[model samples]
Target: MQLKEFSFICPVIESAVVLKAIETVTSPDAIAQTLGNTDSVEERKRKLPSQLVVCLIIAMSLWSSDSMGTVLKNLVNGLSRQWTKLGQYWKVPNSLSISAARQRVGCRVMSQLFERVVRPLATEETPGAFLGELRVYYSYR
Candidate 1:
């Protein structure tokens, strides 16, 4: 039996796709207003800025099964050029940093963000989306 050649290559994601999803969902101004965050005051800083972290959180949610680092890896790999232009050097934070950033961003902000960004997929065209003016629940999972 002949062995098949395998090559590993990750597809690049356009900045517009990711940014558009975020723009539709949440904005930097909205997040800062919600979180009451001020501009960075530290003289020295690490790679994981809060704004990037927020985007990372969304990406992580989209890819729930992947480790945070893996999710970040795929996202950064896909958007390397854009990230570079933004003066961001892609470095996946350790698990501890992820935890801290989550806290720093706050659960309330994230919750409100989800409420605003995430909407019911049901529409008039979808079956039973509106049953006699009462909404239908789909996918209990």
Candidate 2:
């Protein structure tokens, strides 16, 4: 309405490409391992498996503006990658189902996944991360 109210918003990039990047960073095996570590592995296949739920959580960050149902639909529908079942699983679950899946997986899986993958991004040679010749200790607390 007003010139002062105008805001610039960044456009979303291709969904498949972003999903592939996420797959690269968080491989299937790594996800399964984290699930196992958290004792959250599913006993049998379901509408939404544990692994997909894990990925769904990551995808949620990328599609933060969209609803969970829409996000999951985009995530499942955009899997052009050859490794996945793709076309066979186009039937996206409803929001309540997704919520239940999220509940079943619980928070421990994500916490364990974070503990598994997240590490120091800086090496010993980085400028500000280290002192002149010694490593600097940075604590969050």
Candidate 3:
């Protein structure tokens, strides 16, 4: 029998690609506004600032099957240099810290983020987006 190296590519979307697409749709100003509106902005800088947490929450959704730590790592790893200012002492937070940061931000931040950025992709004439004369929406709640 011949031996060959085994390799498999993950089906999960790359963090950089998704983050770029998301950033394009949701501007930094929009994110800041949402965080401010929800009163979830951090008072002091930390490893996971409120802005970073907001992005982390968004990245979490894209990588649902991944652990929070993994999602966070992927997000930080994918960010551009300007997004972070650490030299070399920073490290990925443990699961508990990530959870704490998320809790501090709370549900309102996520809700506000959605409200500020989410918009209907279909227009009145788009097929299948409407049912008869009414517009159809996918309700998660």
Which numbered prediction scores highest in lDDT against the true structure? 2
Off by over 4 Å in 1: 1-20, 37-46, 78-88, 119-128
What global local distance difference test value does model 2 have? 0.77
Give per-residue lDDT, candidate 1, residue 52: 59
Task: Quantify all predictions' global Cα lDDT against the true fold.
Answer: 0.60, 0.77, 0.75
All candidates: TM-score? 0.60, 0.72, 0.76
Which stretches of model 3 miss by more than 4 angstroms?
1-12, 85-89, 125-128, 136-141
Give the worst 10-residue stretch by lDDT in candidate 1.
1-10
What local lDDT score does residue 12 receive in model 1, on the 0 to 100 scale? 45
Question: What lDDT is reached at residue 21 by model 3?
Answer: 67
Worst 10 residues of 3 by lDDT: 1-10
Candidate 3 clash figure, as a count = 0
The deviation in Å at residue 138 for candidate 3 is 6.8
Native RMSD of candidate 2 (Å): 8.8
TM-score leaderboard ranking? 3, 2, 1
Q: For model 2, how does the per-residue alpha-carbon lDDT over 1-141 read when each residue is reduced to its tens digit?
A: 222232224354677667767766677889889888888988987878888898899899878899998888887776545335545646877888999999999999998888887666567766688877677777633
- Between candidates 1 and 2, the one scoring higher on lDDT is 2
Question: How good is model 2 by TM-score?
Answer: 0.72
Q: After superposition, how far is residue 25 of candidate 3 from its true place, in Å?
A: 2.2
